[model samples]
Each structure stands twice: as structure tokens, then as C-alpha cells.
Target: MKQAAQAREVDVLVVGAGVAGLSAATAAAWSGKSVVLIEKSDTIGGTAAIANGSIWIPNNDPAIANGFTCDLESQVRFILSECWDGFDESQKWCGVSKETFLRVDRYVKSGLRVARDLTNTRVQTFTQLDKIFKRYFFSTKDSVDSVRQALGPNHSRSDDELAKAACSSWDYHWENKFNKVPYGKHIWAAFDLRLAGKFFFSGFRKHLWHIVQNMVSIRSLSSLADQIPNLFTKFWGFGSGLILVERFRKHLDRQKVPILKRHELVAVATNGDRVTSVDVQTADRQTLTWKIRDALIIASGCFSHQLTGDGVQDSYSVKSSCVAPGNDGDAIRILKNADVQVNQNPRPVLAQTVIQLAKEKNAISHEPVFYFYGDSFFLVDRHGRRVMNEKLTYHDRAQHHVGNAEQEFLFLVCDRRFKERYWGLGIAVPFDQKHMIVGNNESTLHEEIDRELRDNDCDFRLADNFSANLRETKIAFNEFARTGDDREFGRGKNAFDVLGYMKPDRDHDAPSRSMQPLAGEELYACIYGLSTFGTHGGLVCDEDSRVLNSAGDPWNNLYAVGTCAASFLNGHYPSHGMSIGTGMVFGYLAGLHATSNTKRL
Candidate 1:
């Protein structure tokens, strides 16, 4: 338990090492300010390190570097649609007009500069970025328009909602063609492009415009070949957030930034509305205070019960989260202690429903049974019925699972093949069967079930027999095996459902034929425990990344980013990497303001 004995001084003090804090520390340091970043956990990257790490910056320089245009107006309209009925436009950067908002020279360009710094990419060619980001884009105009027609004008579902349907439907491949518009910023752009309808549609529409803008004579590659380069630049080369955050940390390391892990923010000394300094508590309970001359940025993430019991765990969830071990609500509590109106009682999302296997091969049961995207499995609840699409995006699945009445008691009904296919969390090889509860007839199932669960020592509830009290369960399995149709939950009906497919050219809408009955009339079941992604919500901040007090006054010299701040998407977890994206853009926003002669705190 090492400790910092001397009080330090930094121009910008960043708390939390997740994407938000990491980005802030880097930006402010690069902006000619002395910076110190501290993390409560022993590790630097917070929940972000273990995350998928994709970020969405709509209408970035990549769209225009190759003559691709994004509809700024359309982007604005789509973002506003996230609120469902209406949204406060004034909260959007002081209600900047669409014309003023598209000044990528300010937002997108600067944000990309921040991104380039984080990713360590010298690759600046548009074609190169397009190629790299190809997987991130998928156009959905036809699908959205078709659904829009079906719903008619009476439905009034915004393009954003329609895009959600298309993305979740998994019926189409958008190819990363985000809109030519550069408008939407907060609620819509608040998410990565894939989550919102307008971005997909804009990508769809803009791809056409981009193609024409390129002046192609006949859709010929030769026409564009003259502009395409060797296609790659120097990067940290880690695609997941784990690598990105680490790379950013490396940049901080190069800059001599003091990133103290295992040092948690204990208190803030403020004079009037300005933060004067922050006190940090180390592993051995040694308190070291750092004087903040300019500003203090709070990028500490929202609460997760994995390491600290800071945030409210959903009643239907387990305490463990997939994020870094220290995602307890440090930012929430500290701000609230300062009389800040933090968003209260936030909902927690999970990375995936995870179950720990025997840490040792021959060890007895250690944890819950996990459900994977293998072909031969389906989830059933206490009612022996499916509860959701089962194949929607992970966030949507987490949302649905959290809402289930039998949320705490889901079971993965699978054949032996499925079990063999899914060995453990993130594991492909087979695990020791000692952890599994195997049985023959209906009697053996129920009779040995409780004993096996207890022996395994996990928090899962597996029923005894397949055919005993589960008439509907048996029927659903039989039907799934026969027609490959999850008639109960409509499984495998959309692109999101085909997540198990492992090919470049996959019909995302196709079901893996793994649901068939076993050859020897064998069936099995395990308790599929629902896992949480992470927590969302905290003190709310204005568009400038300034923390707002209970009376709606900005707390001078204090800013919040990442999950430590409330989502402006009207409380909806819309897309992938949004938690990181919002944290990033706003972290960049905080850095710019913190370094400015005009302090916006």
C-alpha cells in the first residue's frame, strides 16, 4: 500500500481513469496545462478498460475527408427524436443553430484530434478510416422506411425509434454510412451512430451522396483507386476500449502525468463556487491532498456493486458487474455531499449475464450458470416461457431481462451440443462437467436439482425435470427444434439474433440451426443468471460539461463526464459505446473549457 506523502499541484485535476477522465487528462495536458489523474481502483482504466470501446462521433472529419457529406439538419432532427415527444433544444450548446453546429472545425475536428491522440493513429486518409470503421456502419433506410409506412403517419414514431427497430431487427447491413448531416449532438449524437435511426438512415442516404460526390463514372473502383492509399497508420492497435484507454494512459505516461491508482477522491475544498483542491485517500488510508489552481474534472464512473456498494443495484440483478472492480459511486456521493442534485436511484446495466466457472479444473461449483449466443440454447423463465427477443443488442437484452418478472430465475434450456459449444464465459473449450447438474428422467431432475445447485455453490436456480412441470417448456423446445422458430419469444427473427454467426458474409437474420433436439433424446437445463452491464446516472451537467447544483447553478471549476453524469438521452441507453462516447466528447469539452482563458465552470 504505497502512498503519496506530499500535497501536489496541477492545473487540471482529473478524477477517474475511464474514457472520460483519461480523455480529459490527455486533452488538458496537451492543451498546455499541468494535470494529475487519480483513480480509486488499483487499475487506471475504470469500467472502460473491459468494455467493447467503440465510440460514435457523427459527422466527423472522416465523413468529409473523402467527399462524404452528412446531413447536419437531419442529424439534429434525429437526435431530438430520442426524447420521444419533445426535447429542450436550449440545452444544446446554448441553442446553436444547425449552421453553427456543423462547424466540425470546432466539435468534430477537435474531437477527432482527441480521438487520434487516444488511438495513436497517424492514419488520416478518409478511405482508411472508412475501411477501419466499416463494421461500425450499417445503412437502414429501406428497413426504416418500410416500417414507417407500416406504422403510418398516425404512429409518429421518430426516425430515431424507427432506426432502433432497424438496428435491432438485424435484417440489413448498413455499412457504416452515417448521415451527411452534422446536426444532432446531445441525445442523438449522444450515442454512437448505430444506436440511432437517423444516423443509419443518414448513412444510407449519405452513402449515395458520397458516391456521387466522389464523381464515379460507373460505380467503378478504378475511379476511386486514384485516391485510395496503402490504407493504415500507426495506432495502439487494440480495438476494444481496453486498448484505447491503455493507449491514452500511455500518452499520459509519456507526458509525465501522475496517474495514481488505488487513490480515491475523499473530499473537495471549494471557495464559493470554485473548487480549490481535492483530497485523495490511498490504499493504506493515507490522505494526500492535491491543490487545484485552475479546474477539477470528475470522470469517475457511475456505481457498480462489483468493488464498492455505491450505487443502487437493481432488485432483479446480482451484485457483480463486468466493469472494472472499482465502479462504486464515488463521484455520486462526493457531489451529493456537496449539495449537488445527482440523478438518484439510477438503473444498472450489465455487460452480459456472467457466471463464474470453477477457477480450478477439478474444483466444485463456484458460481452461476451463464447463457451464451451459442446455437443450441434458449432462455426460459419461472413460467417456462421466453420473455424477450433474446437476440436484441446486449443493452436492449439487459433492459428486457431487467424488466422480467422471473428475472432472477432464468434458465438456459439447451441440448448437450449447446453446452459443449459454450464452455464458459469468453471460453470456447469444454469445461469440467462436475459443475453441471446432470440427470435422466423427470424424477432425477427435480430431485437432484437443488442438491446440484448447492454443490456447485453458485447463485442460480435450476429446475429438476424438463418434462415434469414444464409442459410449455418441452413444447417450446420441440417446436424450436422442428421449425427452428422460437414461437414463444420469436427468437432468431432479426439481425441482432444472429449474433452467434462467425462469418464475414452472414445473414444476420438467419438462425443458427443449433436448436435441434439431440440425436439420443437427451435434454438439459441450467439456471441462466442475468448479469448487469454497469450503472448509469449521477450528477447532471449542462451542455458545457459543467456540473449543475440543486438550484441549477454551475459549480465553478467542477465538471463531470462518463457515467458520473446523467445521460441526456431522456434516460434511454440507446447505442453501443454511448457511455464511453458521451464521456469522451464531453471530457474533451471539459478540457477545452478548463484550458480556455474563459473558464466555463
Candidate 2:
């Protein structure tokens, strides 16, 4: 039987405890409002906790400190260039609509403010990423020198090639016509290495002392350590999304904000044009209601959880999302219930190409296949056609899989040299030999694939003409490699295509580091599929972060931020940390506006 709903009153109610929700609650609490933050899951940090803890803020303080000035106009232009869809400037198209210009303008202007607020308030501290290659991973002395030698000004290369590569390495959309700004916007949550080292040593000593004091507990050390929740190695990691959330969580706790975890937003009750209250369901199945005195901000994330059958797969043709399990479109349902209009972007799912593998007997795993180690490898369709530029951003590369509905899977074909180089790249999870399809030569490779298909014993299925098409494809690839020109997909034309991952060796002599002829005798193929970050489209929101109704009117006490609202950039992903950064920007705006003294409707 359903329990009667217990009622409570609050000045501001923030849903979902992800970066955006936490940001909103923090802003509201700082504004002296009585705010209550809730999370559907037991854990407070959502997908943001598992992410790389970076935020892309234009004209951020760190960048300014580094003497890289990114003006507001340039920020808008850069975003528009990234979202360009062949529309004229007067149409104000950043891919969504004419109003996208306004949204982008607001995002660019307010993003820096949000960053400063978070920093000044000690909610989160950020470090500007200055080096081009450092944007992806933690920079080491060896790596810095390697990249500098490979693409440094003193290197022997034509002006045009050098210039293009430099631009590509730093900016993903540098090739776009509208992008004219210098790159220096991305920043990551600052982590103190010295402090982390101290914590690590302390935790290590505590564990060792405990084991030594209790001689009989030596055999059970591993089990006891497991109960302690990663005390030994947790502080040692450099980049972690949990660090970002932890900072916000600590700030909120200090501000006396009530963070109710294991409490799911059930429904939103609204008056003619304003949200009145929200129903919530506790983990223990107790129903509760919160009457909104000021406003309710819905920052609940995407509808990507698989088992919930939230219709995201059917709606966006997406599979295997890496977001949190609780992001099951709770925000969308509540908004729809309140008669708010939710919109969809043409490309709603932000995804990456992933290889699905069977880790154990019955366990399935999806591993990202973003970088191909050397020029020997290329992604191909069922008929052995080159899938894409391969160097394109992961989000752009995933789009190729859905182009042909009949083409259910893509294959990564590489020689032995490529495989060895890839394995040496120091991936966190070692590639399992069971997922590989091997062949001594092209003919044997074809024969092996044919055998697998006939026996229905493989994860990937190729077309019958794969063998014939592969021969032609190999010749074409070799020709492109020899001439240092990928006329078909233009793979090596971009700087990021070369310097984004591992830095080129100083003694490397290939015409293009991103491309080299396939010389190794043995060949291998791995299956690839689509894996999403999260859904990008949701409730339509204005510049102030107010959720809008079908009539294009704002609901006075309702706002949506993060993945719950249609993103400002529409469907375009402009570099790393964009999703999290924009979410925080809007969340800040929502918190500020929702708490302001406007006539209650």
C-alpha cells in the first residue's frame, strides 16, 4: 500500500546531487535561502564524480593569470563555429535555432562568473590547462619535452602544415570557418599533490600499523581494507571527478544545507504558471512532499540508465551510456507532468566509439576505443569501407555508426605493429586476448572472420564482400600512407590528429606521425559500437535558467539546469569539460534567479 505523503516547507528545493544540482544548492544556500538538496541514489555525486573533474570556463582566472585573454565575443564565436551547420550568421544558428546566439552569448558571459564564484567561495579551486597536450592527461616532464620536440617551432615542417597542426592540437573545431579565437579556456579542479601525498602516507601507515598490532588479522587484511573504502590509493589519483563533487559537498555542509540522499523526486505539482510543490519517494518507500516557498530547481541528469527503459534508446538510438545509474529521466517526467515543454536536439546523444567485450564468463564490458595507436589501424564498416576521419572527436566519430542502419557494427583493423604499439600505450584495462580475431595474413583474416560468422561465434558480424573490399581498402590505405595524404578522410591533416594522444618519438621518420604504412604481417580486428556520455536534450530553458512552457512562457518558480535542460550549445560538444561547465553555469544562474524577489504568480 502507498504511504501518505509527509509535508515539509523549504525556500528552495534542488534535485539530483550531481555537479549542477550541487552548484545550484550551493548558490541558493549562499544567498541566505533555506535550501534542501536531494539525490535519487545513496551517493551524492552523480556521473560527474566518475568523470575527469574538469570544467571549460572561458576567460577563467587561471587563463587570465597565464596572460591568455578570451573575450566574450570570441567565446561566442568559438561556440558558434563548433556548432556550425551551414547556416548564415544572421540566422544566428549555433545548430539549435536563431535564439542559440543569445544562449551562447549568455553562457560565455556567465561561465567565467560561475567559475570565479565557485573559486572565491572556496567551493572549488581550478587550475588553467595551458599546454596543448596537457589538456588530455596529466603532464609529465618526459611527455612535455617529447611534444615540444615533435611539434616545436624549430622542427622541419612547412608553415601551413605546422600552423594547421598547432590549431588542431589545441582546438577541436579549429578547422571551422567561424572560429578565430586563441585556445586557452579549459581548466581542471586543482588538486594539491603534496597534501595528497601526506594523506596517502598517513593512510598507508595506519593500515600497516593496524595489521602489525593484530597479528592474527594479517590473513584478513585485504577484506578489512576493502571495508575501509580505498584509503590506500584514493588520494594518489591526480584527476578525479569525485574531487570536484567533494569540494561542493563540503561547501554545502558548511553552509548548513540539508542534502537528502536516497530520496527520489517523484512528481511536481504546479499552479497555472508556477510550481507549487514536489513529491519525493524515500529509499524506505516513505512518500514525502516539499512545498516550494520560493522555487524548485531540477538539475536531475540524463535518461541513460539501461534497465529503466526510459525510452532514451528508442528516442536517440543510443546504447551503453557511462553516466550514473540514477539518471533515468526523472527530471523529464516531472517537467512533463508540470506541463513544461521539453525539446530535442537533432543529435541528442553525445557518444564515443567503444569496443564491447566479455570480461568474464557472463559479464559484458564496454571500453572506449578513441585513439588508434599508429597509422597502421583504421575503422571500417561491414564492407571494409573507411568509417570516418578517425581523428575526429569521439562525439563526432560515434555518429558514423548510425549513418547506415543496416551496418550494425564497425571493425578496427590493424597489423601486429599497431597492436604492439597500442598495448604499450598504458591503458588502464589491459586488452583481453579473447576479444581479438587474429590472422597470419589478409586471406587468413578473411577466412577466420568467415568462420566466426558461419558459426555465430563472434561479437562482430561483417558483410560477405568484406574479403574483397578489404584488399582494395588496404591498397588505398597504403597509398595514402606513402604519400602522407589521406585524400579519402584527411586523417593526418589536423594537429590534434598527431599530438592529441602519445607524443611522437624524436627519431620518428614517418611522413605523418598519425599515418604509417601497414608493414606487419599478422592482422587483427576488434568490434566497435556506440557509447554515450549522456542525452543532451531536455526541458527548454531561457537565459535565466527558467523552464519554459509550450506557449514560450516561463514557470515563475521552476528552473532546469544541466542535462535536464536543452544545452546552450544545442548538440555540439566543444572540447573537454563542456557538459559539466555549462551545467554549473546554468545552475548558478538558476539558483540566483530562483531566489530573487519577483512577484509570485
Candidate 3:
């Protein structure tokens, strides 16, 4: 039997405790509204906690006030150049309204203010980018000199050659496997492989190391860098979702605002086109209807399998290892049922790629030869076949691959060099020689294999059929080692130059060069899947953070911020800290919008 419905009233009920939702709640509370922020999860922070905690604000933020002066117009032009397809028409003739622009501006400023207070450091958006670049890239000659000293004279040449070989191989492998595939149509399909390798090897790893070093060195500096600030301010809890939720909760607590967690919104009771009240399910399963006399704001997330059968019917499951599990998209489903239009674009804002490389060295010599399997543009197996499209939404990929590919099993066939460089030569093998093989020990590798299988809920298989796969992979690799003709995928072009330069076999005769350790004496063949940060793209909203229906009409009290909304920038251009920045800015806008509307009433 269903429980009787309860009743309550508040100025606002913000759903989802992600960074954006929390920001909205904080803004609304600060504006003196009775706010009730609800989260489906036991705690909040969302994907922001797992992230590096950088907010990419394009213009001059508080940190780099004197370091650099940015012309906003120039920066905007650069962005437009990259996103000409969408911006060319939309930006002309005042397509972006002044009201939306002002709202975005105000939101950004507010976020900066919040960041300044939390970190206790004068940091502007530009300064953050500068800090990141200086820490990671060779901005100064001294930094390059230090890298050279560590790597020795051959570092530049060696690294560049390895990159070149890898890039060439990647391109060749991708085209041979994917070009003729019907769905492989996007230009990015050709570039993704090179981009992924470059970002991981050159960008992400280097930047991460630099940031860690900066954190340690900040104390030594005489200035305010000594005070190591919280990695995430405003948001609280341990994970990404939790941190943002905590920050928002704290803000509301300070303002004496009420919050009800674990309360699920069941339905929207509407009068004509406006939402009059929302029916919610409490922890005890009792229904409670809350009246919204003035306004309503829907910050619910997108629909997932847990919320709708549509997701399950399409084989789309929630397989994110990183995102908050509670984001099943119930809120989105309810809103959609209530005649609220939703944007269901098949593309994801951010896509992830994973590659499996073999790390093994020659038996007689200690030289390493890392063998990377997978095309430059798309993640593929040894047979040179595109596994997924560069822009297929992650949901589509996850749903398609999960539980089907023996999720946990991976076989890494390697030579000796890989053992010496990455892993100390204490090799291990499993008792079942058919399924697991190591030239050395038997227990340790078995244990690792077992653990992986258990974690992914999968079974293990032998490498009996690996010979065919290896033959295909070896053909691609050997071709690059000889001719350097990457006709299949086109390696030494555009962004791929970064990867091309990392090859070990490339000629390093040039005086000015950067080298990567591509020719280390290691070769291994392994199977792995891409680890994702989180999903991007949800509700579509205007610059003012107002949720727009499919017909281009505002959904009276509906709003979205953060990952729940389509990103303003193109999907390919990944700028660090942008997601967090968007969450905070949009959250602030939604809050202000709700507050102002309430005031007028």
C-alpha cells in the first residue's frame, strides 16, 4: 500500500548536489530565499572531487593580475576560430543577447570572489593557467635545461624519434582498420589517437608532476604560496560530488537555509504551463507535495538506465567508475514527463580513449621496446579495427562494451626491456600456464589476475588466439620502423607532431629538439579499456543558465548548470579547470535568476 502524502513549502527546492546544483543553492540562500537542496546520494561532490580542481576562466582572473594582460576580444576570436562551425552564424548580428552576457559576466565575477575567499590567495583565471603551464611546459629555458640534464644529450633526439614512430604507426593502424568503416566519418576520428597519446604522455603526466612539485615548493617560496590551500574550496566531502555539495551546504548553513537530503522528487503538479508544486518521496517512502507559490527551478540531471527503461532497453548502463553512482537521471525523466523538452544529442561533450602498450626488453640486451597497440584516431585491438567512434557518447560506448568483452581479462605479452625499465625484473606466473604465462614466478601474477577478474566481474581467458592478433600488430609496427610512410593514418601532421617526435628511431641530428623514451628495450601486448573522468552534456540552457525547451521557450522555473548542461565550447578543445568554472558560474546565474524572479513576485 502507498503511504499518504505529506505537505511542505519552501521558496526553492534544488535537485542534485553536484557542483552546479550546490552553487545554485548557495546563491539562492545568500539572496535570502528559503532553499532546500536535495541529493540522491548519501553524500555530495560529484566528479569534481576526483578532478585536479582547476577552473579554467579564459580572461584575466584574480591570480595573474600583473603577469599578463589579455584582450578578451582576441581570446574570443581564438575560441571562435576553433569553433567556427557553431560560432560563425550564432555570434553574428547579436545572436547572444546582452542580458545573457551580463548574467554570465556576473556569475564569473562571483565565482572568482568565492575562489579568492576559499583559497586565501589572490588568484585570477589567467594566473591559474599560467601556473599550470609554467609547472608543466618548458616555459623557461632553465626548465628545458633541467629536463635535458635528467635525460642527457640524447634525450631530445631519442624522444622525438619515438614520438614520430608511434604517431606514424598509430595513423597507419587507424586508417587501415577504420577509414572504410561506415560510422567513422568525423575529422576528429583521424586525430583522436595522436591527441590521446600526446595528452597523456606529454600534457597530463607532465602537468600532474609539475603540480605536485609546485605544491611542495609553494612552502619554500617567501610569498603567500606558503599557505597550501584546500584543493577544493566551496565544495565539501571527499569525492568530487561531495566537495561541491559540502561547499553548497556550508553556504546555506551560514544563511540559515534548510536542506532535505535523500528526498526524491516524484512528480510535478502543474497548473497549465507553470509548475505549481512538486511531489517528493521521503526516506520513509511517504509522498510529500511542496507548493511553489512563486517559482520553480529544476536542476535535475539527465536520464540514465536507473531512471528510465529506455536506457536499459538500449543497453545503456551506468558504468562510470568515477562519477557519483546516484546520478541515475530520475529528475530528468520526471521533468521530461511533465512536458519539459530535453536535448538528447547523441554526442558527448568529453570523450575518453584508452590504449594498451607492451613494455618488454630484448632477452640478450637491457634495451626497451614499448609496443603500443591501437590506432591513433580510434582505440583498436591488434587486428586494426576501430573499436568506437571518436565522438560517440560515452554512454553509447559503455553500454555497448560492458560485460561483453570479458571486462576484466588482459594479457600483456612482453620481452625483457619492459621489465627492466618499468617493473623490477621479479616476474610472476600463474599455475594455469594456459591462461597465464610468465617466464619467472607463478604466484604473484595469478593473484593480480584473480583480483582484476573479481573487480570487473569477469572471467579470464588464455592467449591461445593471440598469435593472429600479434601478427597484425607486428605488421603495423614493423612498417613504421622501416619506411616511416604513415599512409594509412597520416602521423606527422598538426597536433600529431607531438606524438611523432616521441619515437625512439627518429633522427635527432637537429640541435634544438625534445626527446621521449620511445625506444626503451620493452615490448608487451595487453588489453585495456579507457578510464573516464566523467560524463559531460545534459540539459541545454542559454547563457543566463535558463533551461530552454525544444521549442525554444523557457521551462518557467527550470535551470541547469555544470555537466548537466551542454558545454559552451567545442567538445574537442579540453581546457583544464573549465568544468569547475562552468559549474560555479552557472550555479550562480541560476540562483540569481530564481532570486530576482521571486523578488518581483
Best by TM-score, which number? 2
lDDT per residue as tens, model 2, 289-324: 878888989888976554211234444444455677
Q: What tens-digit string does per-residue lDDT give for candidate 3 at 1-601?
A: 1111223776777777767777677667655657777766566655553333445443333324422223434334333333234434246422443433433444434554444433442111112222222322222322333333332454333544332222211121121111111110110001123422432343235335433543443322321231233222101111222233444566566666555667777888876556788888878888888887545555554332232211332322212223455545565567665555455542332212211111111011111111221122122332333243322223233333444443322244433232212120101111112222233322333344445444444344434333455445445544543454443443322222222112221232222222112232323332333222333445666666766666666666666776666555433342334556667667766776777842311
lDDT of the candidates, in the order given: 0.52, 0.64, 0.41
Q: Please estimate how well model 2 matches the true structure, expressed as its whole-model Cα lDDT.
A: 0.64
Which residue pairs in model 2 clash with each other? 165-495, 169-496
Q: Where does candidate 1 stray beyond 4 Å?
A: 1-7, 59-113, 116-239, 306-314, 351-371, 400-405, 424-434, 441-443, 454-466, 469-472, 499-519, 569-571, 597-601
- What would the C-alpha RMSD of candidate 1 be, to one decimal place? 12.3
By summed lDDT, the worst window of 10 consecutive residues in model 3 runs over 181-190
By lDDT, the best candidate is: 2
Q: For model 3, how big is the CA root-mean-square deviation?
A: 13.6
Best-to-worst TM-score order? 2, 1, 3
What are the models' TM-scores? 0.69, 0.80, 0.57
Candidates 1 and 3 compared: the better one by TM-score is 1
lDDT of 1 by residue, 284-357 (tens): 99888788888989987876553222233445455345555566678877755685767775656543433333
